[model samples]
Target: MRTTLDFTPLFRSSIGFDRMLNALEAASRVETIDNWPQYDIAKFGEDDYRITMAVAGFSQNELTITQEQNMLMVSGQKAGEDEGQYLHRGIAERVFRRRFELADHVKVVGASLVDGLLTIDLKRELPEEMKPRRIEIATGEKLPRAGTKQIETGKQAA
Candidate 1:
């Protein structure tokens, strides 16, 4: 059972939140959920993150990781392998594609495959203009007192 959500009201009042609202709407209407190649997302530090995917038989050459604007995609396709004779096979050898929506400043750092696990590292690097900055307060500066004026001592003709 899938129910669609109406984001028209949010779009009408929001200016730069269109992508976020669209993501929410798309998540709500997801009917087909694929569980192949299970993955886990973990946060290490304040701006560091890692995604680990279980890929039992996939080699590094057969996998691909792509990153676009605010989006990350990981796909794996099994290479052709010869099977002599198999009475019963429990391992899965199918193609899988996984996508993850990234934040504004999130970037993929590196990736590694070890012990049948594919790990992808990500780090959120905010631009220098967007990072927090301290405003310096000037010292040794005095405000001029109002209604204080020096009278000029000049000769006035009567």
Candidate 2:
């Protein structure tokens, strides 16, 4: 048995869509980054989003949130204890980095910590120029007369 791979037709048909082809190529190479400290991404509305990360035992000062380019990076590092003797240390204070891809015009509003949960709010507002608008078609262009097409068949115009 032999396996033959054929992509000439697909490639030839998508010549005019270099950007889309590149996007598909890029998407194929997307690697699964590690999932650190669990988090949640929620959509509140058409232009609202919220990201909540499980940051127990992490103080607000230990967490840093920054937005660079089109990526939202959240990092955590706990303060070191100098004069503490731990017999059985189970809680992990190791630093972790989590990244999220942000859409165009999306921005981080602010972050707050409550009940050991860190909440990060993000919002995306569409520009006025990008919003959809209703256009009223002129009365003449509404529709061709019902009998107009029948004229070609020698039928009397009603």
Q: Candidate 2: global Cα-lDDT?
A: 0.81
RMSD of 2: 10.3
Clash count per candidate = 0, 0
- The segments of candidate 2 whose C-alpha lies over 4 angstroms from its true place after superposition are 1-33, 136-158
Instruction: Write down the lDDT of every candidate, Cα atoms only.
Output: 0.93, 0.81
Clashing pairs in 2: none
Q: Please give the distance, in angstroms, between residue 107's alpha carbon in candidate 1 and its true position after superposition.
A: 0.7
Question: What TM-score does each of the candidates earn?
Answer: 0.84, 0.66
> How close to the true structure is residue 55 of candidate 1, measured as C-alpha lDDT?
93
Model 1 segments more than 4 A misplaced: 139-158
> What is the C-alpha local distance difference test score of candidate 1?
0.93
